[model samples]
Target: MSDSQKPASDPRYPDIRHVAEARRLRSQGALIIDALGGIILCPLDTSRADLRILDSATADGHLLTLIRKQLAHPESAELIGTDIADYPPLDLPENITLEKQDILKPWPEKWEAHFDFVHQRTGLAVTGGMERAVETVRRFIELVKPGGWIQLVDGTLIDHKIAEDDKAWVKLFKVLSQCVTLVGLDTSLGVSTAEILKRAGEGLVRNIGEKQGVSPLGKGASSKELEELGYVELKGMHSGFVTMLKGMPEDKRPTALEQVEGLLPEVLREAQAGECEMRWYAAWGQKI
Candidate 1:
């Protein structure tokens, strides 16, 4: 809600290079754009006299793939993507304008209650515990124009059943769970996203719907992509946790990192064998 509450040195916020790779591995390079519900792509009203869409915490604007393919584009559909930095001049379509804003801070007064759709990927936006995440959701609600929709997608929630039969997945997920928990956020955020949004938006958020299914990471098209995403998620977790281990024995830190690095091969092997299936949720609702 205030600038004083902003997170610092967030390793969860990956660089452009990391974002490029991660998005490529997700939703056929649009970062799960395909998973977005019809509320966005199929808006009921055709009167685009003043349509607006907000892509918060958009990294490199890759999620605008659909807009870029618009041959008969909506005359007033404005796709604005915001992030902390432009990061070496992203290549975005004309309809998708790039802006600089950190969602952890208060958004511009002009932006409040003024977007037909507000979309955010949790891995790119909110980090930290429930209180912080709730506030972030509140900000997202603030940006939505009345009768607009807000959709949120969180990373694959850690599932012990998926790891039970695979040692590599077990190891990697263990590290992920520990790191995410340390940051005061639930590992089940992916599965419980609807509740989070409902809690944060209470009176305003309505008609909640959630989509969640197991995506294979082995011997399937989606599985192959999941392999790539898993690698990045694991590496990201390692990077975040290593920083938090500052007071630990210097020798132990590197060793722990090394151990994490070693698990990569197992992730690859298990993924190749189709032993990993990630479950994530895409929860959305209208702001009434």
Candidate 2:
């Protein structure tokens, strides 16, 4: 097929197709929120009845629903969730609206400075590079009113640490990195997000703060509960790696897939030994 006529492929991770993937995304989102200590991390009072909040890349409206429940007056607050594709859950409250929005592009004029708080999780890297990420953050900042806040969350792939050198683990990571890069997903954006936000909102935002944490992978976790959670994340990420591998150019696809398939056993063994861990970053700032 001609390149122009080829079907478009989504570069985003955690393909939301089956019940399992959906559940995984929900669970992952909730865990990150819990680790960060709450749904709304900014200094703003979430209990305020008139607050306006936006959750970008809000698949299935799960986070929005949670935020709605926490509000002092759910009916009075305005909560909107936007994604490039609509997968909204059923029976949503009237005050919560889920609409299809391409966050990488310009939003409607009416949305400018319309929200009291703007949030995005694991979304910006889809822009493919730092420049587009910055552009997207600027738009996010624009969506907030004076003194409103914008927050972001994503993995800092670069900050990951291993207890010992494992050739198989390193090889698999290199292959996965190639796949994400080819798919236009910058997995390292997590650490850079805070700096990007600062650059994106230089004169417009203040009181910027960032937090980081490591989530152990597989059975190497500190506790049974964490071990299970880490396994879930690892599994979901593996699925994404395979999905990206499939999207590679035909000439390069076979070799890369073969390499990843061959390395899985060793990689899993290393993770099970608790030698693998991943890091994430949460950054938030308020508009001046």
Candidate 3:
């Protein structure tokens, strides 16, 4: 159901799967970050009391927190987080409603043109392939009210900045990309969310916008917080790491896997020491 790694056994690890992802997304969501309410709803009549928002495919509900930032009061919004799995304990569990949903199935009839805003990030992994991902985006746009807002965020799996000599991680990244492709998922789909929505949305969506940024990790990092975030992110990719390695040429798989596994600890150290960077992106639009 996901490409990102699940929670690590370490109790102290933050719920963030990738700090680079959280950073770029939070920055893009700042327009409605303060939760002052009615600001984003400015497009609607001020007297309209109903304001509903949804964060589909949420796991830990971080993006839902960003969506909640726009509400003035708990009751002023109907916030829902939808996923096939159980909702994990959120930072503010009481603030939003959680729903059990399988996006591959048809969207509920009640959800049609129902939300004031819809937010999602790095969610296509749930679709298992690009065609279903495209369908999910189409349904996501359709769920928004006319003149409502929506935002989608995703990241590149192979996007990284490392020392010229850091060919090992780069090689691992290529393997990861191939692994994802062999399974029918687009490794770089996150960078294309805006374009996908723009093309599929056509007359239904307007004011389409997208922006991207690069974040430093490890030894190239300017701060410890960023560095730690990078380390955590790399750790989260471990499962995909294993999967990608196993997908390599059968003859080389065993040796390559062993080599990459041994170097990961140092690779993490490289990020903490300011030696690496990751790229992420976001796309948003208004439902017209």
Candidate 4:
């Protein structure tokens, strides 16, 4: 489908910016350190090397920014950021370049077999189908040079249990998941990464690491800060998702937004109550 034909209210589009910021913070905090260390310890020679990096479905160059700032292989490295629509307004370092392309489509003409590292995060639900999305990712692996790395990070909305069972929060999560699923996407694609990679014929797989934690509610707590930022992002996402649904003949946009608004207070209350927890997963592997 053409970009304009797609609804402006799509949650995938709205969450792009907020998700980028969250990744930026996480990269600077602990994630980047681990990624860099992993790259350094890889079996590749660091000296006299040529590296090309691709950030597939890069929302706002969050991961690219972190890599440019941290990696020492500047001369040998080139970075490309791809997205479905227009690239977000991100200030990238000189080493990075932005390209307007959809991950669902084939790799751009100039990028075939050009990357040494392919990194992507959070696109399973944004793309139209899970298998199609995995196929695109497999094509991304084809674009990488031999003995390269492919890293992916995403989370499922499962197990978002609350101690007190706040109805509002539960309703919101369920509705959000349902809306996205209606478009042929899965919110919980993280659990399937290993299997997808294997299906893509990628070998020498290594389970880098995985992390799980509860999203907090207070400002000082880690998960709380994420929720606060995520709430702000949700306003835009809700508007976008509602707008998309309104375009449908059977969907009612006004009622959707009204329900979303009604749920907000309860979501915020649950956030404050420290009663909810969100689980996340991250992993990486190599192509033989």
Best by TM-score: 2
Tens digits of per-residue lDDT for model 1, 1-288: 333222234544322234433344333323243234322442424354556878776656766555434423555577888876444345656677878787778999999999887887654224555666778888899999888888887655453433445477666676656555544445656666777788888998887777754455444534455456555544454444444454346553423666665676777677667676555567788888
Score each candidate by Cα lDDT: 0.60, 0.74, 0.60, 0.56
How many residue pairs clash (N, CA or C atoms closer than 3 angstroms) in each of the candidate models, in the order given? 3, 0, 13, 4
In model 2, which regions exceed 4 Å deviation? 1-8, 12-16, 88-91, 158-170, 220-223, 262-266
TM-scores of the candidates are 0.75, 0.84, 0.73, 0.73
Per-residue lDDT value at 41 in model 4: 29
Estimate, for each residue in 145-251, the C-alpha lDDT of model 3 and write its tens digit.
88887777666677343345755556556555555555445657776777777776888888877766666654554455555555555655554466455545766
In candidate 3, which residue ranges exceed 4 Å CA deviation? Answer: 1-50, 125-132, 159-166, 220-222, 243-256
The residue ranges of model 4 lying beyond 4 angstroms of the native Cα positions read 1-50, 127-130, 158-166, 202-220, 223-240, 245-256
Ranked by TM-score, the better of candidates 2 and 4 is 2
Model 2's lDDT to the true fold?
Answer: 0.74
Runs of candidate 1 exceeding 4 Å displacement = 1-8, 11-49, 67-75, 157-166, 180-187, 222-255
Per-residue CA lDDT of model 2 for 1-288, tens digit only, reads 442223334555425444455556786775576556677777877777888999998877778888888888788998999887545255778888888788877898999999998999888778878988998899999999998989988875542442245466565555566556655678777778788999998999999998876666666555677667766766676665675666667686534576666666776777788876766688899999
Report the alpha-carbon TM-score of model 4 versus the true structure: 0.73
What is the per-residue lDDT of model 4 for residues 132-243, given as tens digits with 9 covering 90 to 100? 7668667777776666777765555543433345466566666666666666567767666555555654454443434333333323245444546545533443444555
Worst 10 residues of 2 by lDDT: 1-10
Candidate 2 clash figure, as a count: 0
Q: For all the candidates, what are their Cα RMSDs to the real structure?
A: 5.7, 4.4, 6.9, 5.4
